[model samples]
Target: MLYHTSPNYLSSQITDNDQLLFQKKKTNDLKEKKDAAKQKLAKVTFACREEMLKLREQKAQVQLEKLTKRKDKIERLIKLEHEIRELNAKTFMRIKPMHNPTTTTLYQNIVNIFYYMMVAIVILGFTYGMTKIAISTFDSLQNNQLTIIAAETNLFKLKEGVSDIFETKKVTTSYSFES
Candidate 1:
């Protein structure tokens, strides 16, 4: 190939070199801007991750504190319930001893009085029955003795009358069969 060297072509070749140098400078500026943007994004991502970790730790701490408070409250409630039960037991003990004896004695005295009254009534009934039996027996014995006397008198009169009718002169004495 035969080379043709022209002055205009040589000037155009210098201008093309200058344009290439400008394009290269523009490319370097764009690359620096891209690198700076990437660095800013990396910093922002790291800060966000750190803040998220801090939030998680704070939430865990809050939950732990809540659990501890709940446990303390439960313990206090249990202690209060136990104290109440103990107080109730003591009160019952004191009241039981204080009240039981008087009522028991009262009931026992009433029962004793009733028993004595029943015994007296039974004794009186027995005495009355015995008196009635004695009175009836004495009355029957008196009536029988009177009837025997009457029968003896009748027998003596009849014997005298028969003796007179037969005109008997036998020697007779009073018959004595009494022992």
Candidate 2:
């Protein structure tokens, strides 16, 4: 066909060849439309894929954030556990020396230290388990799966354990919850 270029965006009128080409183009418009539709579909598919990749990346970021928080919490809990253990040992050693306190003081300190150690150990275990569950739930949330919904029950169990441990000590201390 005839070919031409414009200095600006304007164009020349039709020649015989241009007319023939225009006729041919009209005849082939249906095929062009089909080609256009196929191109549109390809573009849409690519767009969908890009969106999927973005979502996956977002999920990965969320997972990374949760992992970072869990790492921090784990480090703190480990430090606290270590400190409690050391304190328990120190308190035990100090209480065992009767020359240190002959009155009921040594006995009370020993009992308190033992119970405190037990509480710390139990709490540490629960903390680790809960952290693991929280990480797992993050995974499940990203994957759109079921997650643990037993936090209340677990808290109740911990409370019961605390009560049971102190039952024999006749400790009737009332605990208050803050909103």
Candidate 3:
């Protein structure tokens, strides 16, 4: 009876020890799983933050580019406007001559008269040159006709002389025959 009681007590003590060890092992495994999960979550959060920062930087860069483009456009427009203003000022100066209307008109009229006079002179010179050419051509043609007439007259005189000599020879032959 004493041995049986001792064995029962030893068995109960062993069971209690096993249960405690099992509970401790389970707690340790759970803690390890929680730590791993926290690490994974931390990595995911860090990646998300980096991505957000990159996106923000890209957005800022795009905005800066847009602003620069707008600034350039505005500057070009301003330059063009300034150039236009300068051109207008120059145009105003050019038109200032019209402030004295009578003088401007008189000058313009003088220039127009000169231009017309030059044109008339050119036309008169052309007419004179053509007339000279025509007169010279007429004179040359008249001279050629005179030369041809003179040649014809000389040829006629030669033929008459030859006929007269032949007649004289016939007369002489007749006298000789009579003798």
TM-score of each: 0.43, 0.39, 0.49
Q: How close is candidate 1 to the true structure, as a TM-score?
A: 0.43
- Look at candidate 3 and tell me the lDDT of residue 165: 93
How many angstroms is residue 93 displaced in model 1 relative to the true structure, after the best TM-score fit? 7.7
Runs of candidate 2 with Cα error greater than 4 angstroms are: 1-27, 94-179
The regions of model 1 sitting more than 4 angstroms off are 1-4, 89-179
Comparing 1 with 2 on TM-score, the higher-scoring candidate is: 1
Local accuracy of candidate 2 as per-residue lDDT tens digits, 17-118 = 577798889869978999999999999999999999999999999999999999999999999999998997666645644334443465677776687799
Worst-scoring 10-residue span by lDDT in model 1: 94-103
What lDDT score belongs to each candidate, Candidate 1 first? 0.79, 0.79, 0.83
- Record all residue pairs in model 3 with backbone atoms less than 3 Å apart, i.e. clashing: none
lDDT of 3: 0.83
Taking the tens digit of each residue's C-alpha lDDT, what string does model 1 give over 79-109? Answer: 9999998896565433323324532343555
Cα error, candidate 3, residue 33 (Å): 0.9
Candidate 1 local distance difference test against the native: 0.79
The 10 consecutive residues of candidate 3 with the worst lDDT sum are 94-103
